[model samples]
Target: MVHQLAGRLNSIDPQAGEALRIVSYFDVLIARGVGLDGLLRGAALLSGTVAGAEIRGRVTRRDPDGHAPADAADARRRSSPRSHDTWTVWLERDGEPGPDDDMIAERLALGVYLLEERRRPDSGIDAIIDPNRSAAERAVFLARHRTDPETRVRVLATPADAADTGAPSAIVPTRYGLLKATLDRSGRLAPPEPAGLGTWVRADRAPESWDAAIIALRLTAPDTPTVDATDLGAMLLLAQAHDPQAPHEDVRALAALDQRSSDVLRTLVEADSIRSAAGTLGMHHSTVQARHEALTATLGYDPRTTTGRMRYTAAALLLRLIDPITPARTPSA
Candidate 1:
């Protein structure tokens, strides 16, 4: 009956018939639960061009042959209006668009939106990390995940989409902007560069772990990408003492130093001897000695001394906490 109706429509209006066919094709794909790849492939075949969708930070593209192209440039394309502020679907046609081009693009966008809704995580990571929620509510979520109040878990915080560990995760807002927090049970999670691993704590104390994780993330640097909370020990206390509005004199001084000078200062404070610091920095001992003298004169403290080293380390850590690099805004599901 559907085919006969389509035939009759084609006889009267070919464009209307093609529009109906495009709608029916996407409807069937949706009913069969075809994933993002299937949806893109169907759109590409129907439009006789390359189709693509970028959801969250991930991009997927498919050519008419159902294969991903190496370099699918964005030219002569018709894109659907941005949906949910996180995704967009488009078709890159070769010549003038066909009569049903707009319809195919619209249906592809709708298909992707439906698929994202269906695949959205139902996990309670957001509730578990949210401080606004009551303890009873958090406990209920923990129980649903088979985690008791006393079971220990560490939170790993990284930049958004930085890690793909299959652990339960969520994008959480912090003083440092949006960060992706993943709950790790085994304590062996190796997140990507510039990540932080919070100290192990009870499930009920997850909020504390999250706080510590953000602190650790701030402490990460070019030389050290991942920082463990336990290693920080008393330094964590110093982090709480910071006042961003009224910056410390030492932190301000350290921030003034150029990158090369900062590296030299960091090496001098961390290394046991001048020779060792020079070796680590791959600089001649004389050059390092000269830079050290220059830095000491500029900062009004001899960083090689025990007290100076202590002061320099504390100031450096604090400087990281106040880093001004703003993160991207939180993304919608």
Candidate 2:
């Protein structure tokens, strides 16, 4: 298996030789049923060829001062998420590890392979990251990192511009999939396609972080060329509220209006002023005013009012959930 992987890695680029060897060592330990914690320890030792080499995963919360929050793992078994997003890997030797452009590409590709394997046993990397090891092994692994400050959890998401790639195995046929990568606490990322970022956390919280990462990926715009979890913002909140099966009453009401009324109402809501809406819709000011009053009567609220505006906006958001591809404002009605 090592020889086969070496050949494939060499084909991708000769530089991958070192990484492939590391992965191969990991593979051996995995086949021996050495748990993830053991694999990480082994990786740290293997990377010792580099000066002061260390390998560890961290769930980092960055502060405005360009620092990470103090280690609070002793009092916590989970992440106290604040601006909570992205998981990162630290591969350091003599200097602070960082992901430059080239390193980002490498990590992104590796992450994609690892993520696929996690879902199903597609390659050797799968065995390395899986958490379901024997109780003894898991205990041993936990013992090794019990004092570590970083949370040992991960979040994975795909970037917008993923590419077609083959599976990690040399003989497996290639297929298209999102490229994924792990980010660091410093917010550095490799270019991602099936892009994702992971962090260290209490073992139990890993799945929650992973779910958030998936939500971030779903909110990512298709036209967005790159992926970053930090940008999810309120979109994540909306994602939490989004219910595809729920009846969207306001959205339905908006859709039920006539084309001119719908267009006029949307314009009024967007522009905030009747005159501006009239200019935008190319209708007389009085005509727009009349439509606005008519819409208010139909919807039982004046759209210009704050309460009405909130409903309109929420309905618009709901409409997006319903038919995201459709324009925010329908044509005619």
Candidate 3:
């Protein structure tokens, strides 16, 4: 009977024969309770096709269910109407024509699901974004999935006050060998604005890369569409330390000043000289100089001095991190 079935499959298409044989092997492995790693490898080997294969799963905003992994048959029996996670098996081939695309794709998805249920501890992005996951766990999970040294990860995050309505976010890797060109072209397209936060880090450092991505997102100007983690300097460190309710003594001091006064101090700290500061702010050089003197009197130090510049820069960074929404120049002072 099996031989007859195989003969019939081959008569229809040689590819169909191969697909059935692979599916049959998957069934046997499912019965034997093989892991996802085993099932995926076996299927790829049986087909003797596909350059690469992987299971891509959707990321839900919430945690996934804790049900044990089940075989393809069980998955068919107990499929749910609503799933927080959905997965599909992706097969890649350079140029060879596969026997049956749709049929093999479906069977591969089923096999992947069976093993993935057992292997995956939690949903992908959910685990990364979850505050409850230890740094160790996040690093481990992210590193495991992004094992390729050349793969770069990008993250789009918004400030707490920013609305969530924006361009949709994507977390998938770029198709091999196209990432750099794709990234370069992204900024030149219509709408002509930067898009999202991006970072390039070794796969092992995913957690740190994510941290930088989020920081860059917050530091970026509202008009700019994208920000790279590498461009951020001391701002990254300051953003990391920011806690709105717990401003430092110097930060509080800077915050208490009227807008113009704070702006003048911030400008002085950032500019190369008083003349340059005045030029940037469109203020008279003497006016800036006078404000600098007054700031020195108010803060008990001259911000133009070396030590004062350091302190003032720290305060300015804190202000930006904690109150990024406020205008840099206020007229009230």
Candidate 4:
């Protein structure tokens, strides 16, 4: 029955696969018939830890109807039509699992419902605008930053070339392997303008309201690189399910199984060898030389130097894509 229930629950939401994994992890505990309370607590703890979130503790007694307890009922309600908590809040709270394995089920439903509601409203810009002082503040900022030079100012200045201007300048090569920007006016850069934030945010801001703040908290890292969590997690889970205790050796073996070219490149990079990387990786020396040569041709520099390493690192990330931990998140009340 538990297996049947789990199979049904697993199919409920693709996004909540990780939670299913936790359930799978505790399947053994459940089958042991260690009492409903013990199983739930075990599920909760395992789910919380791996999902990097929280779940409710165990429930002592079953509900009157011989169904899941009342708290689970309330939780299901809250997660569905009456989800009061935001995404961040939902993830952070220690909500309990319902008696039925409907936690992941409802979360997916709620997500789809909310998405539909958003589309239905179709409020567009009006929905997003702060409605209060958002417009006023923007106006004020524009008024200050707006410049009025006597001669009609160039409304939009094509980026300047200052090497001739005699000021110390740095020419940044752009994506197309061309000099893109020349940083002429600056003082050691005011700690790199974080790319993710914009004018919508305030200078003296509540960290919660700021894009950078919310993002910094929610994200795994500044440059964690976005991924389809479901796919990555599933891959990780599949690999782990095959061999949980042997992750290291298994991962290495799995990594080796990746596309031939990528594996060799990664192996060479890790070993810091440019020469025999081709032979050991099963590619011809000429092919390796051509790839190496083209690496420079495409990126516009030598691969042995720091500039080359930057290109190599970028490629390496794609080559060494880590199999996800087989479920990005977990579920509960």
Candidate 5:
């Protein structure tokens, strides 16, 4: 089984070697009958952030001021989670999904993979700065200082291969009909096709190889709940590209409108809220519609599509709004 998995890793693309670590984690886990869901629940306990992957806590320590090293297992051991010893969380084994030696090896491999991927530049997208912007200030390092003033910034990225490639592998393989759904949720492995596989497929007709990457930014529409540093960087770039003066946001106050009239505008954007903004705000359906009307009069963009949202959020954050070059208001996200 180890040999088979090794061969699979060898077959992965060179640009994707960094991500196979995550694959190895799952490979070992599935070989032992432990599924990713178990890993997910286990991960939630240690890391405050829960992701649908084999658990190895995120470690963000990349600032001028030294910070503590972050690790999933270490975090789990240290955190005061509710389910430290529920005992109900048993490992499957012997034809059933068990968290045995094989599972341990796989999960560990996954951890290593994610760790290395975070270090990769491609996956390490800068959320604060837009790729379209000019000057060093348009980079994540500089832009973060402007976005969130009170933040203690710590940036995390998906594994390099994981973020750039196709759909992740779906463990607990079911019938063929359900394979795509399973892949979509795993968020680990990658496939080349998008039809029945996932959304990470390559496109030949694109203007550049990055066409798929650009499309992904548009389609991902990541909810605030599932926000990742890499995705955040992508959004910032998209926002800057949409409007140099606007910031990307779910909803922002329209300076031009009165509070009462603005409330109605918020309702419009709320009704057709983009990605995860609606869920984050715990807002009503009409909220997006309400916001849209106001944005149209102010930020100069639509909130319904990716370009629009990018413009809106940037305007909201004032990505490049340029307000007297306020001395780096927010710390970071």
Candidate 6:
């Protein structure tokens, strides 16, 4: 039996036996058609450590116990050989590399690549969002697919999951980073993921919607997951024109504030009264007042005043625009 042969091989040569076991393990996973989560779980269990993968902008990880930790730990990583540098798999281990580390990483990466390839749609969604594609070509693809004229485009920090309603989606490369773009006919604003919702447009004008969606996505923050293009109004112009590379004095000043100060300032700006801000921040009104005065002195302007509020709002928006929380890379493909 293969099990008897494997046992004999293990007794004869430990390293070779381990390698064979690794190969067989992944082969069975592939045969079972496990997804990224399953693949990471399998790798973690086999290595007795944590395993993770970053495909496009979506990150998934599994600890050895099969639990998904919220934070990523330091780990050794390997890029998928088959992808165009779009994906990577890593093992979070403490000590020196194991003898089978290379083999485990290689199989993990390959499995992730194959799974992603299988999930890729053979549809016009790619062409419709591709900026380099000619308008005529995009139009042709739209017509071929019979896309609705009222469809809106949404750009997300992560890929859509099974919970999401079925929509034509693709990974779009943007100046900020790779984002998962989806075409939605539902016209709903609430998305489970952090997203930028674009304006409703005809199939031929989808590119414009795509552009607006990217801007809206950049404006989203942890507290604000989804931003609608329709809600932006004229602020969209500011986002379009602002260059993240050049930090203005106000932006620089705002950036210098510590987390505590930043939270207080944001609460102050949104709250109608100091008491309201204090309640929202879960701090005493007197304590909030003191902090507000201190922030005014530190910021060189009272954020509560009309003119000061405008300045703080602009600076805050500009800050979020320049410093997105998620990590992204330029498209290699």
- The numbered model that scores best in lDDT is 1
Task: Estimate, for each residue in 1-333, the C-alpha lDDT of model 5 and write its tens digit.
Answer: 223434555587532332333344444443344433445443332222322222234222211122222443323322111111111121112233222323333343343343333344543222122224343333443332232222322221221222233432111111110111112222453333221121222111111212223223223222431222234445445533553224234333444457655454444444544334445456654674455455665656665666865454444443223211101010111
* Candidate 1 residue-wise lDDT at 275: 94
Which parts of model 6 are misplaced by more than 4 Å? 1-121, 148-165, 186-192, 221-223, 270-294, 327-333
User: What C-alpha RMSD separates each model from the true structure?
Assistant: 16.4, 20.4, 21.5, 18.5, 20.1, 15.0
**Tens-digit lDDT track for model 6 on 164-282?**
44566655435554456777756753455567787777666777778788778778777877778779888877777777767678898998898999999999998999999999999
Q: Provide the global lDDT of candidate 3 against the true structure.
A: 0.49
Per-model TM-score, in order, reads: 0.57, 0.40, 0.43, 0.25, 0.21, 0.55
lDDT of 2 by residue, 239-309 (tens): 45766556367777875777777777878988958999999999899988888888888887889988999
Shift in Å, residue 79, candidate 1? 6.0
Candidate structures ordered by TM-score, highest first: 1, 6, 3, 2, 4, 5
Q: Give stretches of model 3 more than 4 Å off.
A: 1-123, 129-152, 158-199, 223-225, 270-288, 324-333
Superposed Cα deviation of residue 81, candidate 1 (Å): 6.5
lDDT of model 3, residue 192: 21
- The most accurate candidate by TM-score is 1
Model 6, poorest ten-residue lDDT window? 324-333
Error of 3 at 19 (Å): 57
* Two-way lDDT contest, 3 vs 4, winner: 3
* Candidate 3 structure quality by residue, lDDT tens digits, 106-194: 44455444355445553354344334577566566555454343455444444311322332221221100000111111223221222
Candidate 6: give the clashing pairs: none
CA shift at 270, candidate 1, in angstroms? 4.6
Global lDDT of each candidate: 0.77, 0.44, 0.49, 0.32, 0.32, 0.70
Q: Residues 157-265, candidate 1: write the lDDT tens digits.
A: 8885364687878664465545778888888778887888888988877887888888888888899999998899999878867775566899989988989999889
Worst 10-residue lDDT window for candidate 1 reads 324-333
